[model samples]
Target: MIHTRALTKDFTVGRGEAVHAVRGVSIDIEPGELVAVLGPNGAGKTTLMRMLTTLISPTSGEATVAGHDIATHPARVRRRIGYVGQGNGAGHTQRVHDELYTQGEIYGLDRRAARTRADELIEALDLGALRERKVSDLSGGQRRRLDVALGLVHAPPLLFLDEPSTGLDPQNRANLWEHILRLRERHGMTVVLTTHYLDEADTMAERVVIVDHGRVIADDTAEALKTKLAGDRLTVGSPDVRTLSRLAEALPGARDLASSGERLELRVSDAPTAAAELLFAARDAGVPVTAVQSHRPTLDDVFLTLTGRSLREESSEVSK
Candidate 1:
């Protein structure tokens, strides 16, 4: 449904110092796929999405969104895709239902169809109770839902969501995702979303694309990336740190070993089996292990493994 070849975008600030926001990003997204784009702040995630949505012109390369050239057929691309950006797109003074209906009309829907579609989306996104409320009066989560409804008023085949759930609480986030997943399932729409929530990307996305320094660093299913890049983590606590370290060093599949006082941590391809064997070895060697635990790798682990920086830490730094 979308294809790009070496798509890049550069911007100039004061003194004409160029900022490379997106660099040679080439990726293909198939129809009916839900892909999550993850990165830290200033990682060109928004820049890439803007280019794909034709909201901004790229400095170099080519991209086709929804089968229309983003540069040559921007209007056609806009007509076939819906974009819900990070900020609220609805006007504060407008009522929720009115704004949605107006957007439908702007998309060329007739009066009756526009009203019908507006009502449908209002119900679909759980905005029925707030239909008569002004956009400014709604809470952040409510406003985001209205934005999504406006984007889908035209029933476009593809949807682009840039940090749609960035500021919502856990309940609101779950609610938004429920509505989004339901809408996608009902319409079989292709969804490309960028988010800071690692757990969301790990659990929700069929595929993940990791961006850093305006480049595509990794792309694969969440499980595949975690297995190939991060593996599982094993934390062992022992009074005999030296003995535990020696045993960990001798393990065949262990790597990235670290010792912190009584705690020893390492990455292994199979943590469950490795943990059992390590415990047995510690007992036989009189290492006096105090505790042993295995943890599955998360998306953040994969990002850290690839970039040598924790994604969570990067996100926190960006927020600051």
Candidate 2:
């Protein structure tokens, strides 16, 4: 549903100092695919989304969204896609149902059809409870759901969500995703979202694209990237840190060995085999193994391995 080739965008600030927001980003997304773009502050993720959604034209390269060329057929692209940006659109004092119906009418739906779509969305997004409430009076989660319902008023084939669940609580975030998943399943929708939550992308996205400095650094399934780049972190705790360090150094495929006061941590591809071998070697060398634990790699671990920086830290900066 989406294709891009070397797409790039550059902006000029004060005194013509250029800011390259997106750099040579090439991606292909199949129909009905749920793809998440992962990145930190000023990572060009928003710039890329803007270009794909036809909100901004690229400085270089080409892209087609939903079978329409973004540069030439922007109107068609807009008609075929629904974009729910980070900002809320239903911030006005209009009633929830009226706001949605107006949105449907704005999309060229007839009076009856617009009202019908509005009612359908109210039911689909579980906004029936808030139907009579003014948008300005609804809670953050309720507002977000209303925003989503507005985006789908026309039922576009593709949807672009920019940080759809940024400020919501954990319960609301979970509820939002449940509604989004249901919409996708019901319509076989193609969803492309950019999110700062590592776990959200890890668990929800079928494929992930990691962006940094306006460029895509990694793209793969979350599990595959974790396994290939980060592996598993094995921390063996013992009073004798020296023996733990020695065991880690002698083990095959054990890298990044570090001693933290009394515990030794290392990166290993096979956690089970490495843990077992460490215990056996400790027994032979007269080193007592106090405790053994293996932590499976997360998307943050994969990001740290690739960029040598914590995505969580950068994301916090973005939130600020």
Off by over 4 Å in 2: none
Enumerate clash totals for all models, in the order shown: 0, 0
Q: Clashing residue pairs, candidate 1?
A: none
User: In candidate 2, where is summed lDDT lowest over 10 consecutive residues?
Assistant: 243-252
Question: Which residue ranges in model 1 land beyond 4 Å of their true spot?
Answer: none
Residue-level lDDT of model 1, residues 1-320, one tens digit each, is 99999999999999999999999999999999999999988999999999999999999999999999999999999999999999999999999999998999999999999999999999999888998999999999999999999889988899999999998999999999999999999999999999988999998899999999999999999999999999999999988888888888777689999999999999999999888888888889988988999999999999998989999998888788
lDDT of 2 by residue, 1-320 (tens): 99999999999999999999999999999999999999987899999999999999999999999999999999999988999998988856799999999989888999999999999999999999888888889889999999999889988999999999999999999999999999999999999999989999999999999999999999999999999999999999888889768878888789999888878999999898999999998888888878899999999999999999999988887677
Please give the lDDT score for candidate 1: 0.93
- Cα RMSD of predicted structure 2: 1.1
Report lDDT (Cα) of residue 162, candidate 2: 95
TM-score of every prediction relative to native: 0.98, 0.98
lDDT of 1 at 225: 96
| C-alpha lDDT values of all predictions | 0.93, 0.93
